[model samples]
Target: MATTTGTEAPELTGLPLLGSLFDLKNDSLGTFLRARRDHGDVVRISAGPPGIRTTVYGVFSAAGAQQVLAGESANFRKDNAFYQEVRESFGNGLLTSQDEDYLRQRRLVQPLFTRRRVDGYAAAVAAETTTLIEEWRDAGAGTVDVLQAMTRLSLRAVARILFGTDVDAAVEIVEDNFPDVGAYVLRRGYSPLNVPRDWPTPGNRRAATVHRALYEVCDRIIAERRSSGGAPGDGQDLLTLLVEAESAEDGSFDATELREQVLVFLLAGHETTATSLGFALHLLALHPEERKRAHEEVDRVLAGRTPGAGDLDALPYVTRVLKEAMRLFPAAPVIGRRAVEATVVGGVAIPAGADVIVAPWVTHRHPDYWEDAERFDPDRFTPEAEAARPRYAWFPFGGGPRACIGQHFSMLESVIALAMILQRHDLEAVDTVVPVAPAITLQAAGPARCRLTPRRP
Candidate 1:
């Protein structure tokens, strides 16, 4: 018995044949917003021949997001084209894993990110960020690319706390190949043709080479740790925890699964954290009053010392700034899921094979959920204001069972890094033009450059 999908969905008409392909590729944010503005919560944007029916249903409202993310998540699993595409470089890691296997892996990794473990990671985050600020001091008033600075700082933090290794070496490998993989993915995603990764095409070949190198990086790190009799940080960090704590053969991650977990941590943790912090610092750079307020809060909370994990609650304004920045520039702006069964989101009939997109950027800034939707106002996240909005309105870390495992870890890392930077320096925006580049992660398409000025003592 087929359940009839309720309410007719308004469709966004596009050019013949190409449909909305070019529009989505060139101006995804604009295209998504336009669909919402014109068609209400459930907007259908097709991308195929005139009547061929290869359509994508965009969920634009917070309630629509709730339908896909929380309301009926069981019917709409992560078995989608986006996950298939991401699995090319990183393999079937937790980022792309599903159902039973995913649950097993999640349970094994859950203990590694508990509050106690995350609190333990604070010292490494503070030390790495303080070192990064010191390097800016050594440069003596030189202009810096905030994104690059943040990438290195974040990668190092993950390496030391999670991998328990000398971060400089891993940082070099991560920096070299991550951008290559990301750019290749973005190009492939936007390309009209659907080329498989196994094909011998030049782009596929290049991506393969990069993924191989990335896998090798993971292999070497794991091999070294195992060869050392698995004495990883004396069994303190996640690497050691994963290796030593074997709940069951069916309950734990094996060698291959462990490698995928590392890649997930490295990319998901390192890239998203860097991107979010980059935007946070950039927002602070543009809004001096907010930055000054953040500084005051940090000063009051830390009292001239580095921010520890314990002080996360004390720095309410700093947390709000992060919350606002993520709302504006969500690291993973859009999350995709393919419906395993026929479903309706916001009263639109979604056939079984349809790809459903829940764009946080659109939902977060929806006029219905947000005031002055485009403005950078951290106060929108204050207790009273946030409590009034729909819970799904601002899910930077996503929602439901498949939410980012490192959400807590990322928050702690970002707050510590941002506060530490504010304690030592102030970022002044230099690049006036920051384009939005939709890729594996959303980042400043242009150079996220800023003037690094030391704070006056």
Candidate 2:
């Protein structure tokens, strides 16, 4: 590997072999902030003691992020270590696959998320949201587990609406273990140790057990649907579409492929939505003025009625609130790409197989790009304001061709979830100031607790 252009990135100094791994593992946001504060935009992450030094680059600048995620996207792929940790459970799902296989998966599954197909699922989303609100009503509103409530609501919605299944044991498995596995995979991303899945470690064993259950559930869904004369291409649910979808050259997804894709969609579809809803509610709880504005907007728009697909665009501030919340604590914090061929990130040479990190967490909060970078301002995402910034500057779902396939679906779902929650209840924070827990997704270190009081009859 030889360097050609641009200044050599300053190597970050830390303990031997472990290098910056410990710091990254413990405080990912803090470590990234300090690196940008101390070092310039492009910083060499680790040069571990002798045998372990890898050419990993932590990219903080928007231009550098663009070079990896969009400009040279073909040169970089998702077959890196962190994705590999995911591959063990997901197999060749869209999130982890590369090249031809990834392209094939994308083509097969994308149609299900198109505006029309997603529109068809709106009824289920609303119904699931209503069901959750009823459950909260029954609980009588004192110090509710906000994340837990959102998680259940989100899983039920994803399960019924997208997968077209009743919220069952399988959804429970996903709710239980997806985060655990996610935390492990992301932990491996920053830590020096690369524990093998076969090692029978507690985390490894737990992930394996959960994955097996999830796969079994996928198979069961497919089998039951088939038995009921609901074959692939039924054009009913996303699961059915994937079961039946194929390309000219690519044949149908195999049993293994179906399981992996279903699991990935289930985790990606609901986890981010739940986390975002939880954070949004928590933020509103902290700021009464914002909460009041949200309530006023909902009253003016829905007028005490339930939100529907027609009201998606009608409630712009709710969407803006979702946008700003995601900007503050993005679901996917650090998006990574490994150079399959030698490429340059902003002219800093990156050899093949080296990791390049592009973080929304860093770029979205850049003082240069964002005014009053730390404040919670939903107005920043108004069509006019959003159009003013660089496209990649505020990517929460991600960017480029390999961005989250369910982005539109996620956005619509977030709006509906938030609108419904606001219409039904006023949430007050039971605990303020939760520590950040970095995982495959970002979350509070503990359950985000809130007291929900019914705002509607």
Candidate 3:
């Protein structure tokens, strides 16, 4: 057994054998919030039964978040079972790669995500948003499921940008299959013991089917692109960039690796932005005053013209609305890692090889840092107020060297889509409360239903 150092975190009391397993699997967001409120910054949580039990250190304070995700990030590696499952399912893409593989991947992928480069995708984002606006308008005054609608819009935008003319080949495969894949990853990832995946269990069989379809479509698309000898149209799509992205020493991605990278982009690029946009729209619908402020900002900045990337800075209030929505419902609510060695976070000792989780959901609402934390207040993100908070106080995108490479892209898509929506329609909350479930991402468990009234005369 490894020797420990410093003060140990308090253990969260749980049911006899299952510990916090059921609570965590069912209501993770609420569980993390209550754990933070009851146990303070660092809490030791055990799940499962007997010999197979797993203990995870929940780091929920802003200071603890900064330390775990940034300050002592090197001491905390992405070697946990959850990451292992994600790596196995998704391949060693940017989200799951570690050490040398991660470094190489980051180096090759970083150039494509620069602000200027991501800004180039804004036109694609706006076009997609316009398509959605037209669809809603055409549907008349009927209520729309915000989550479902945003998910399609975001997936289509990313697929179009990634595949160009090959977009049709990839969209349905990714959009239809990712949910099943995510559910499989979660179930197997959290289980302390699992029957061998080759045994053909019901879950395993379904997962295999979904994985095959997803991989086959991506492989077909890549093959066609390679054989075609040129990219679609002007060759500005992300897939073209990936095909051409090469370093003298590192070289370029092979067909299989290209599929992995594409899978990662589709998963991270669309879903996270969808979660933010859906929640932002829902929050606005519920809060009329804030929605009004957003409307005024969008109307003033856009002036009845389609918004472009250049207008990003011109709509500060709209940006704040998006920021606040992310604060409340971060896409990746709970991030898991393993302590590489014994470490102290927020005065709590973490054992070597301990499973650790930093929850942005709880950290963002820390009573010590946020006033009236549950309130939907976009002003909380103003320059002065943000500067007053801890660095990790609001990390919808994970922090440290592994911080989301798609940060700029997600923001750009979100800002453009959100601003455009507010410009075209006035939203009313048809579903007063949106119940959320924290999975691979924060999911709206119930419909985020809203009634859209066209703003045009």
User: Which candidate number has the best TM-score?
Assistant: 3
Instruction: Write candidate 3's Cα lDDT for 1-457 as tens digits.
Output: 3335679799888999889989888887888888888899999998888888999999998878888888888888989888888888899999988888888888888888888898999989998899889888776846899889999999999998898877767887887899999998888888888887788888999999999999999888888778876577898888888888899977888998899999999999899999999999999999999999999888877889999999999999989999999999899999998998898887889988899999988988998889999999999989999999888889999998889999889989999999999988899999988888876888888999998888851
**Candidate 1 lDDT over residue span 1-457, tens digit each:** 3365577678897897778877887888889989988888888887755554367788877887877877788877877656766776677777988887788778777878889888888988998988888877876856888877888888889988767765665677888899898888666554546766788998778878888888887788777777776644555767777776567555566678778888888889888998889889888888889989998888888888877899999999999999998999999988888877887777788788778899998998888889898889999999999999989999999888888889999999999999888887877889855788678888776787888777742
Ranking by lDDT: 3, 1, 2
Q: Relative to the true structure, how large is the alpha-carbon lDDT of every model?
A: 0.82, 0.78, 0.88
Worst 10 residues of 3 by lDDT: 1-10
**307-369 per-residue lDDT for model 2 (tens digits):** 777788999898889899898888888888777776556666666677878888888888768
Error of 1 at 104 (Å): 0.8
Off by over 4 Å in 3: 1-4
Alpha-carbon runs more than 4 Å astray in model 2: 1-4, 187-196, 199-204, 231-235
| Candidate 2 colliding pairs | 17-49
Task: Give the lowest summed-lDDT range of ten residues in model 1.
Answer: 47-56
